[model samples]
Target: MKSTLYLLLQIFVLVIFRSDVFCQEAHKWGGQKDGTFSNPVLPADYSDLDAIRVGDDFYAISSTMQFSPGMVILHSKDLVNWEIAGHVVNDLTKVSPNLDWSSMNSYGRGIWAGSIRYYKNKFWVYFASPDDGFFMSSATDPKGPWEPLHKVWDVSGWDDCCSFCDDDGQLYFIATNFKLDPNNNKKYNIHLFKMSQDGKTLLPNTDSIIHQSPGSEANKLYKINGLYYHFFSEVKAEGRVMMMERSQNIHGPWEIRQLNHVNKTVDREPNQGGLIQLKDGKWWFFTHHGSGDWEGRAASLLPVTWIDGWPMIGEVGKDGIGNMVWSAKAPIAVNKALKIQTDDDFSAVTLRPQWEWNYQPRSDKWSLSARKGFLRLMAFRPLKPDDTVRILLRAGNTITQRSMRTKFNIATVKIDISGMYNGQFAGLTHFSTKSYCMIGIKQDGEDRKLVYSSDSQNLIGVTITGSNVWLRSSWDYQGLNRYFYSLNGKDFLPFGNSTQLTWGSYRGDRVGIFNFNRFATKGYIDLDYFDYQYSKQ
Candidate 1:
């Protein structure tokens, strides 16, 4: 009966749309016109997920470690379609200088995991830094001037953290300490602390060891049906699986169960996420595949079936264990095609939310106002340049955006290099952390040469006659990269050898505009516009 019902649903959807349109929407991301949505709802790298619904708006915050304006928050009308809501930490330098551009550190270690909750009429966010303690922020509106990151704890070695507000108005905080204590004992324990209801501070002498397991983290707490459910993940002998513990009291004497026990795609394990109960009382789970690739930790929505007070995520089996779901019905009835902003003319009052500097950028080096409508990037030497090899990886002024994982992607930028000084490299790059590739114009004495550089090799191409050159980067779903250049905006010439895109540093491959001087910090380039596409064009 189940199989027959599913077949009928499939037929119904195919009849609602043309076969080609249905096929394309099935293969693509986001909400389909026929009221169904594809899996990996967010097909790019939005790591370490946590989501909530405020009224009719669905908000999710993803981990954006090392990048400034830390912790990207996304807004959505339907759970399947999302947009950039805002960021949590406005100036990451307030958290630490190591995340700043000149420091050139924090490659893969910044904001790791945390929780988002609506308590006492405000939105509260709690997150953990591997080097820093738990940080908190709040805002009445999901988008806008969120309270600055307040340090709830000052100790380190703490990973995934969460917040819970009980019905009686008591607040509780939970976090995992995977590091050793003063005694050097291997402590993989989840510690629960009482917090002030105002969301200001942690209460003293209220810390309790609630649970312990090998490689335990990703803690989420909820009070449903007079029973408390503590959701987390633990790395058992079989691998990391979802675990749930329940009790009548917030504290111990708890019964535990493993919610899941498989990693069919071992690297991309469905481990960490947020659990939400919608307006109609139906539950949902938003999760990310654990290990990352070129498409880093993309977000997926799974239905939650409440069985005997237990929330079984994805497709629950007769054994009561749940498996990951690839496609499912939309949580709400809304017809909208959503997209992350990719095209920028540099004409707005501020940089588009889609763009982010490689790190906390040097304030005086980049300007959107220096020119009428172009983004001017001043070339500067890296704080510590490789004496043997001057690679773009070490360049500090690269502004970038994520490269979409689709059937095909084309990113093109128009750059004016007339202001470039000698010994400067300015151009378009794959912006990949590993096995990356870039094609740029090298400034020499009155002669501009096209150079294609990558992690393994750098090739010098033809010197162009024009001062303005157009650079293009094209990639397919397989993550194969190719480069092209054009003297005129109309026709493009393929210029470089083929290279591959790799998602390193827990982020996806990005499309970047890089500028640096190997000799002196005297050159600059103006980028007029950046246009991107992902469909079969």
Candidate 2:
């Protein structure tokens, strides 16, 4: 009887423990047991990707548009598991003063659709800012110490640039001159220009119009098997389709073909990206699904094949075009799973790779070493017409990270409010251009209150005298979000109404930590740590 009772107790404990797990175990799309992986190697928005293989390692760069650390560089050995290696631009002020805290106007416009190449034994990254100009940066190591940003060309009305070097040591630059017509359709002229071998000066008389098509962008030039392959993305009646032009010579009458619908069932419009060959001599195309919704454009990997001197995406169809491969054997062996950074203890010497400021923060306003093991955020008066509405949107130093497409996610941060001044609000926020919610401490005169604010109104809650407080925001891919707080570290109580997280202006939702001064630039907040947890349901 005793042995039976012990066995029953063990079974009961196991059942109860498993029941407490909030997140469900879902498919980790990178790879599965049969040596195949599903679409979207990454569930988050890694828009406008340019991927290249350097020996056994792979490196990719993506557009981060309004985010401070301009071009984000990602690294992977197997092309399946990826993580943030570093960023190209550290100073948005280098782009322009308008990108700084005072103006806050560079949203959805800063850096767009750059290209990455392994050349001269170094990793070369090139991007163009519509408002600013063209820029380039290089690093011997992808995880830098990258060299400072260099202004390659100071011109506008152009984007989606790529660089190439030929066998004779002649270098060329290819991009699109996106002169919009009256109907707002892209003017669609792909231009080729001669560049200095050092990639600094653009020769004026050397410009050549390579191709013209509607929405012709994301131009990548490659010399494969003695043929110059020029890739372009164009919008069609069906959807966005991948286009490729090839010629035996760099300047030529090129042959163009529309590469579309590799696997129509999986994703009909997997367009606008680069292709590479693996170490095993297998070819693959890294693409972004054209159908971008609230989650933004997610990254997908598809197999590629070369037939009759033409590169085909996925498998060839009856029409001679390739279809999307919903599941294909891993191009490289499945290594350990990796992901972008999300949690922070503020213990490292530098901030985590995932964190990016809304704009380039003022140097005097924030620091990690002001207090040991804490992020010190000093409040500054926002430069908006009114401080009583959407103040956080205009406030600078709003550090943030992207929200992933998982079933369950919670972002929590512990803030010490002893440094807060009157009319100062510091808290954790779910930020988007359309909507936002914040649960944090607000100081008014002599009273300090814990408040939940959303949609231009504040719901004042408990009065707090303690120096430390915990704020949390939880959500899922469906956008159902709730804000919670904890007086102690253990017990959390929900406070705010559940709001649906929304996306806007070519960007996804971001979880952020913010501090703003409504009265004067006089207060500060110390962030003890930030914790992010997620799982699929």
Question: In order, what is each prediction's RMSD in angstroms?
Answer: 5.7, 7.9
lDDT measured at residue 463 in model 2 versus the true structure, 0 to 100? 97
Report how far residue 32 has shifted in candidate 2, in Å: 3.3
Tens-place lDDT digits, model 2, residues 1-537: 999999999988865653321111233455667777766677667889999998888889989888878788888888877889889999988877887888887777888898998877888888898867889888899888888889999888889999888878777899988886898766979899888988777887999998988888989999998999999888777667888999998887899998765222236367878899887787889887665545566787988878888888877888888876656788877776666678899998888899889988888999988998999999988877285566777888799888776667888899999999998988988877777888889899978998888886779999989989999898865667899998897899999788877676667788899898877989899999999987621
Model 1 lDDT per residue over 1-537, tens place:
999999999987775753322222444766666778776777778888888888887888888887766888888877887878778887777767788887857778777788889979999999998887889999998777898779888878888889999998999999899877699876699999999977768899999989998888999898888999899998877678888999999997899887765563432567888888789999888888776667666777888987777888878988998877767889988536556778999998788877777778888999999998999999988765564243666677888887776778899999999899888888997765554678999888778899988766878899877879999998876678899998989899998788767788788887889998887888889999999987621
Worst 10 residues of 2 by lDDT: 18-27
Scored against the true structure, residue 249 in model 2 reaches a CA lDDT of 85
- The total of clashing pairs for model 2 equals 5
